[model samples]
Target: MRRKILLLDTGREWGGGTNSMLELLKRIDRQKFAVTCCFYNNYSRGNSETIESILNSIGIPVIFIPQRRQPMWAKLSKELLRTLFFFNRSLKKEMIARVDEIWRVLPNAKAISSIMRAGQYNALYMNNQPSTNVEGYCAVNNLDVALIQHCRIEPQLNAALVKRVNERVDAVIAVSHGVNQSLRQSGVDAQRCFTVSNAIDIHQTLPDRAEVRERLGYAPETFIFGSIGSLITRKANHHIFQALGQFKRAHPEAKWKMVVVGSGPEQEKLAQLAGTEMIESHIVFTGFQNNPLDYLAAFDVFILASRSEGLPRVVLEAMLVKTAVIGSNVVGTAELINHNETGLIFEYGDIDRLSGYLMTLWQDATLRQRLIEAAELRVREQYAIENYVSGVEMILEKCIERRTHV
Candidate 1:
C-alpha cells in the first residue's frame, strides 16, 4: 500500500518555497504516495488553494483546514503592530520573536491539530519558514508524525527556535548544501538531513527564446540582461544597477540593455536610481511579470545579486533557458554556478568585479555562447524535474520507513 503524506502551509501563500511545493505536488507518483495538502486561510494572498485547483485538474483531492477567519480589525491591528515592530527590529527580527508570536498562534495550532486528527498521514511536510511560523506552533503538541521541514533560507538569527524545532522534526530537507550545513551547525542532526535543490518543470521550460523575445518588443540583436525576483533589499538589485552602470560605461559601444523583472518596495528606489544616471535609460523595469520566462528569453545574460539564497528557482530557470548567468558568490549560489564554467561568479559585495564579468560576457560572444551551451547541458542532465521529484520520493519513502519502524 502507498504511504500517505500531508503537506502543510500555514496562512497559505505561494512564495518561493510554496512554489517549489506546488511543482512537487504535481509530479509525485500518486500510486506510491497518497498526498493531501492541508492549507488554511483560503482567502490568503497567492491563494494556497490554487495548489488544490492544479491538483484537482489531475484528479487529486486536497483537504482544506479551516480556521476562524481573522476579522479585518484584528488583521489590521496585527499589521499595524508588525509595521511598528519592523521599524524597530526588521522583518527577520520580528519573525524570531517567539514570545510575541504566542497569541497569534492558538488558532493555527487548533487548525493543524484538526487536520492531523482528520487524516491518517504518515508524514507531514512543512514548507519554508516553518520553524517559527504556523508549523512551529502546530508542531508543539504532535510528537508521532514524521515531519519534514523544507528549509529555503538561512536565518541569521533565531538560533533557539530553530534548535527547538529541529529537535522535533523528523528531517530537514535543505534546498541547497549551504542550507544543510547551516542547519547542521544550528544543531539539527546531520544524519537526518538532506539537500534537494529547487527545480524547474523541464517540459514547461522548453520554449523557443527567439520567438518569445520578438513578442516582448525586443529585436534578436538586442543584448538583454535580466533579473527576476521581488525588489526586496536582500535581493540587492541596487548592486546590479551599480554594476550595470559600470558595464555600460566600459562597453559604451555594446548594444546591451537590462530588464528588471518583478515588483516590490524597491521598485521606486531602483527607478529613481536608474533615472538620476543616463544609464537608467538603458534600464527597463518590467514591473511584476507572472510569466518571466518570456523576459528571460529576450536576455543574453541573467544575474542574481541576493545577499543570500536557497538555490533560487530563477537560476535554474535561466539555466534551462540556456541563458548565461552571473550570480553572487554566497552560500548556495556557488553550488549552482562554477565560475568561468557554467556561469560567472563574483565576490558577494564586489561591484567592480561584477561589472567586469558583465562587460566581458557582453563583449565576448564566443565565451557567452560557450557558457550558455554548458548551462543548458547541465540543466538537462542533472537538474530535470524528474530527477528532483524522484529524489523527493526517495526521501519520503525513507521517512515512511523510519516512521513505520519506530
Candidate 2:
C-alpha cells in the first residue's frame, strides 16, 4: 500500500519556508503517500495558526505536541539566567544535561507515540533545520520511520543543535544549491542532501499588468519599482530607499514610484529614514498583503536587498510575473538572476552600485524590455509548479520504494 509520512516542524511562525512547504504539500500525491503534521504549540504564533487552518481546510491532520508547549526547566532557567544573557545566555550545564532536557521536554516522543498508535506512517518528514523537537523521538523511539529533514535557512545560531539533528535524520533537503553547499561545509552527509529550488504558483503570481496597475493606482506611464518581504535588517530595504532617493535626486522629474510591501520590526525606522528623503512620497509601504502578486504585477522592476537567503519565493514570483529584477548578488540570488540577461545583480550592501543600476533600468526602456522578455521565458521553462511537484514526488517515491524493500 501507500507509504505514510509524518511531517514535523518546531518553528511556530510560517515564513517563506512554510510557504514552500505548503506549496509542496498541496502537490504531493495523496494516493501514494499519506501525510500528517506534528508541531509545537509553545512556540505558536498567529502565522502558525493560520498555516494550521490552511492545512486543515485541505484535510490534513495536524498533531499538536503539548509537552513542547511547556518546557518547565527552560521556563525556570530563563528566569534564572535573565541577568547573564541580558536575553542571550543559556545554562553552563554539561552536554548530556542540555541534550537530555531538550530530549525530555520536546514533543517528539509524543509525536512518535502518536504515529505508532495510529499505525500508518512508514516515514517521517521534518521540515526546516536542526530541530531537536523530533530528534529524541526518532532516534530512541521504537518506530523505525525513515526520517527526512528539509533544511530551509542558512543556519546562523544553532550549529551544534542542527549537527545533532542532522546526525539522526535519514535524508536532508536543501532548498537551493547554495544552501546545499553550506550544509556540506557544516558536515551534513553529502549522500543525503538534495537541492530543491523554490517554485512559484504562476496562477497566483502571473497577473495581468494593466489590471494590477489599475488596482494599485499606477498611471500607465508610471515606472513602478517594487520589493516584497519583511521590513527587517536582513532585507536591507533601507538601502533600497537610499538608492532610490539618490536616483530620484539625479533624475528630478522621473515617473518612478516604489511600493515597499510587507511589514516587520523595522517598519517605523525605515519610514522615518524614507521620510527624510525627497522620494519619500515615491515609496509606499503597503504592509503585508495576502495578495502580493497584484503589487508585483504593477512593477516594472523588482528588487531584493537581503544580506542572506535560502532562495526567496519573491524573486521567483517576480520573474514569473515578467517583472525585470535587480537583487543583491547574495547566495541564492546568483542562481536566479544572470546579470544582464534575466535581471541585474549587484554586490550585497552596495548602495551606490545598486542606485546606478536602478537608474539605468529606469532610463533605458530597451534594457528593461530585454530583461523582462528573457525572464518571462526562463521562468516559464525552469520554475513551473509541475516541475516542483514532480521532483518532490520522485523523492517521496524513493522513500516508498525503500520502505517496500524493507
Candidate 3:
C-alpha cells in the first residue's frame, strides 16, 4: 500500500519554499507515496491564482484550514491575565502559555488531528521550520503517524519549542547544511537532522534574454543588476539599492539599471530609499512575476542581499540562466557562492564591499563569463531535481518504516 502523507504548510504567501514544495510534489512517485497538501490559508493575492488552484491543476488534493478569529471572552481574559501577571515573570509566562494553548495551539492541533484521522494519513510532513509548524507536531503527539519536518530555513526556537521538537518530531530534512547546523544549535537532536540541499530542473526552458530585455524596455547594451524575492526586511533589498547608489555616485558615467522582482510589505519603503539615493529613475520594481526566470535570463548580473536563508532557489535559478551572481555572506548564499570562483560574496551589511564587487563584475566580461559557466555546471551536476526528490522519498520511507517497527 502506498504511504499516505499529508504535507502541511502554514504559510500565507508564495515564496521559494512554496515553489520548492511544488517541484517536489510534481515529481514525487505517486505509486509509492500518496500525498495530500493541507495549508492554513489559500495563499490568495489580488487576482492571482490561489495555491489550491495550482495544486489542483497538478492533481494534488488540497485542504485549507481557515483561520478563525479569537472570541471576545478569550481576548479579554488574555488582557486580564497579562495585567494580573505584570509583576511576576513566571506567572506571566504561565499565563501566556495558557492563553496560547486555549486560543491557538489546541484548536489548530485538534483540527489537524481530525484531518489526519479522516484521511488515514501514515505520516505528517511539515513543509516549514519547527517553530512555524508547532500545530503539526502537536497533532502527531501519541499518534501512530510519523512526523517529518522539511526545515527550509534556519530556525529560531525558544527552550519550550526546542523541547517540543526534540520530543515529537521524528525527522528533519534541512534544505542546507547551514539549516541543519542551526537546528542542532537550537537543541534539535543531531541524530534527527539531515541535510538535503535544494535542487532545480536543469532542462527547463527559459525565455530569450534579448526578447525579455526588449519587452522590459531595456537596451541590449545596457547593464542590468537584478534582485528577485519578497520585498521584505529580511531580504535586505534596500542594501541592493544602497550599493547601486554608491556605485553610481563614484562612477557617474556607468550606465546601469536595477530590476527588483517580487512584491512585499517593504515595496514602498524600498522605493522611497531609491528616491532618496537619487537613483529612482534607474530602478524598476517589477512586482511579483509568475515566471521570474525570464527576468533572470535578461539580467547581466543577479544579486541577493538577504540576511539569512534556508537555500535560496532564486540564486540557483540565476545560475542556471547564466547570470553572474553576487550575494551576502550568509548560510545558504555562502554555500552556493565561492568568492572569486563560482560567484562573488560580500559581508552581509557592507555596502562598500558590495559596491566594489559590483564594479569588479561590471568591468570584467571574462570574469563574468567564467563565474557564470562554473555556477551553471555546478548546479546542473550537484543540484538536479531528480536527486532532490529521490533523497526526500528515501527519508519519508525511512520515517514510515521506523514508525511501523516501533
Q: Which candidate ranks first by lDDT, i.e. highest?
A: 3
What is candidate 1's lDDT per residue for 1-406, written digit by digit as tens?
9887777766443457766777887778988999777666442222234566676776666667565555666556666767667766655355534433554576666666666666767777776655545544464366477777777877453556666665666777888889888877876778878888777877773668888877788877778988988888998988888888887777788786789987788999998887755587788887666677777777889999999998788888888888899999887788889888899999888999999988888878899889988887887777777777888888888887887799
lDDT of 2 by residue, 1-406 (tens): 7777777776755568778888878888888878887776423233444666878878877877655354566667645555444543334333334544564543456556666557667777777675434453343356556666777766543566556655555667777898889878877778878877778876553568998798778999888988988778999998998998889889898887889988789989888888887677787888777777788878889999899888888888888777889999887888889999999999998999999999999888899889988987887787877777787777767865775576
1-406: candidate 3 lDDT, tens digit per residue: 8999999998868889999999999999999999999998888644588899989999999998888888787788878888988998777866777777778878898999999999999999999888778889888886899999999988877788889888878899999999999899888899999999999999988778888889988997789999988889999998888999999998899889999888899999998999999999899988888878999999999999999998899999999999999999998989999888889999999999999998999999999999999999999999889988999999999999899899
Q: Ranking under lDDT, best-scoring first?
A: 3, 1, 2
The TM-score leader among the candidates is 3
- The lDDT per prediction is 0.76, 0.75, 0.90
Taking every candidate in turn, the Cα RMSD to the unseen true structure, in Å, is 3.9, 3.9, 2.3
Which residue pairs come into collision in candidate 1? Answer: none
- Model 2 root mean square deviation, Cα atoms: 3.9
Model 1, TM vs. native: 0.86
As for TM-score, the candidate ahead, 1 or 2, is 1
Candidate ranking under TM-score, highest first, comes to: 3, 1, 2
Prediction 2 TM-score vs. true: 0.85
